[model samples]
Target: MTRMVLGAGTGLAVAGCSREASALMDDYATVSQAANEPVAGLTLDNSQLMGIREAGLQRRVSGFLSREWSDHFVTLDNGAILVDINARALHYWSEDERTYKIYPVSVPLSEDLTRTGKTSVVQKREGPDWRPTPNMLKRNPSLPAYVGPGPENPLGTHALYLGWQYYRIHGTNDTRKIGRKSSNGCIGLYNEHIAELFGMAQVGTQVLII
Candidate 1:
C-alpha cells in the first residue's frame, strides 16, 4: 500500500465559487500524482490517498476518504446523508443512487459538544433565521436572541433541520470554519454548497452522523 505524510498543514481549502473550484481541481491533480510515492514522515494509507483523488473528481474541497452508502445505511429510500465528523466531510447519495456528492464541513468544537447517531432531515429552510440554542446562550450570555435571514446571519443561506433538537446541517457565513472542528454541536457547510444541498435534500432524508 502507498503511504504519504500527514503534515500538520496538509489540507485542501475549498472555495465557494466555480472559479475557485477549478483551481482546487488543478491543485488536487498535482497532488494525486504523488500518492503512490512513499513519504518520509507520519503517513496515511492507500484509502486516504484514493480519497484525495476522488475528491478532485467532484470538484469539491475535501481532505478525507470518500464514503459508501452501503457502509452506513440499508437503504437510500428518501436519499441518505452521512456526516463523518472525523473526516469533516458530508456524503450524500440520491434515492435512485444516481447522484453522489461530498462537501467539506465544520464539526463540533469538542467531544462533549458533539452528538452522534441516526437522524433525518425533519425540515428544510431557505433564508433560515438563527437563534442560539439555550445552552449556547448560557455559554456566551452576550449572544443575541434572534437573527433574521441575510449575510450576517450565522445560518447563512439554507439549513436542514435534523430530528435532534437544536441540531442542524446548515450553511455558514464563516467559511473559515469548514474542514475544521469549529461548530457548536452542528454541522456546517459553505453557503453555496448548502444551498445546492438544500435543493437536493428533502424533509424525509435520512441522516447518519459518525
Candidate 2:
C-alpha cells in the first residue's frame, strides 16, 4: 500500500456539489466488483498500483460479497454502520429499518493502519478541524500542527469520531480519494455522502469495520 502523505502544504480542493457528486452516488448505489479498480486517468504510485492489483485478485479469489445488517448486529437500535474495507464501502441502516444506504469509501492505506472491530460514534462534528496524528507527524515532520475547518481541511464537511481513538468516518475534500486505499487510517466518504450521513447518524450509532 502507498502512503497518501497529508501535509499542511497540500492544497486539497473541495469539489462541492457537482456532477462528480451525482456520479459518486450512482456508483455507490450500484457498485460492481470492477468498481475497485483504480480510477481511469488517476495517477498512482508503484505501490498503489500493486496494491490495487492484489486487491482485485483477492476480490476475484474470494468472490467478495456484501453482508446484511443482521449478519453483524442483532439489532439496529440507533442505526448501524458497517465499513467493509475489502469492498471499500460503507453500509448504513436507519434505526427504524426504513432506510438503508451504501456509499463508496476510502480505507486505510495498509492493513497495519487499519482497525477492524465494533465501535460506536462517540462524537459528531460539522466543519471539523484537523490535526495530524503523532505518528503522522513522525512520518512526515512537515505536516502542519493544525488545520482549521475549511476546504483545505482533510476532514471535509462532517466527521463522526468513533470509540477508537484517532479513528473516524469522515468526508474528504479530495474526492479522488474515495473508493480507493488512500486514507491514513480513517474511513473516508464523499462530502455529500458524509453530510447526508451526518444528518442521519447520532453520536451513539453503532459502527463495525471489517
Candidate 3:
C-alpha cells in the first residue's frame, strides 16, 4: 500500500461538495473500481507461484488477501509497495526491492496518542529502576516501590519517552509479550529487539500511527 499523507484540506483540494466535488467523486469511484479488479494470484511461468514443485519453496501465508497500508508502501530498492500485515504476524514484503524485508513492531496501548512530531527519547539502562513519578502515583495512586532500578521498574532499559511523562516504549523483564499488546501506553519488546531497532532508527524517525 502506498503511504500517502492526507494533508489538511486535501479533501477540499480533491473535490468540493459542489459540481467539482461530484466530478472528483466519480473519478475516484472509477479508479477504485479498476484497482479492485481481481487479478489471478501471483505467478512465475504463467502458473501460480505456489504451484511450482521446487525444494524449500511454498506459500506459507494462505488466507485472506486484503488491501492495506502495505499497499503503496514502496520498497526502497525499486519504489515498490510492501505489505506488513498478514495472518502469520507483522510481516513486511517488499516487491521489487528483493533485498529488504519488514519487521514487526509491538506498539503498546500507551495513554498517549500516536501523532506526528510526537518525539521519542531513547534511554538505555540495565536493571533500570521503576521510580513512580508523582504524576504516575496520581494516576495509579497505589504504585509500590515507586523508585530504584529493580525487577519491577516500569521504565525498562532503552526508554523512548513521548513527552507524555510516564509513557514510553522500553524493555521488559517479561519477554513473553514482546510481539503482542500488554503495556500501558509504553511499547514492550525483547531487549535484543529494541537494541536492534535503536540502531536502525535515527533520533527522528517518523512514527506513523495508522
Per-residue lDDT tens digits of candidate 3, residues 102-203?
Answer: 332334433252222233343434455565556445766655644455433444455544444665545544443333334444554445544444444433
Highest TM-score: which candidate? 1
lDDT of 2 by residue, 58-88 (tens): 3322212334689999899899999888877
Question: How many residue pairs of model 3 clash at the backbone?
Answer: 14
lDDT (Cα atoms) of all candidates against the true structure: 0.70, 0.70, 0.35
Q: How close is candidate 1 to the true structure, as a TM-score?
A: 0.73
Q: What's the residue-level lDDT of 129 in candidate 2?
A: 90
What's the candidate order when arranged by decreasing TM-score? 1, 2, 3
Poorest stretch of ten by lDDT in candidate 2: 4-13
Estimated TM-score per prediction? 0.73, 0.71, 0.42
Model 1 regions more than 4 Å off:
1-63
Model 2 residue 159 CA deviation in Å: 0.2
Q: Write the per-residue lDDT of candidate 1 for residues 109-204, one digit (tens) a residue.
A: 789989999999999999998887888778767666877887667677899999999899998765556666776888988787798889889999
Residue 184 displacement in candidate 1 (angstroms): 0.7
Off by over 4 Å in 2: 1-66
Candidate 1 Cα lDDT to native: 0.70
**Global fold similarity of model 3 (TM-score):** 0.42
Q: Which has the higher TM-score value, candidate number 1 or candidate number 3?
A: 1
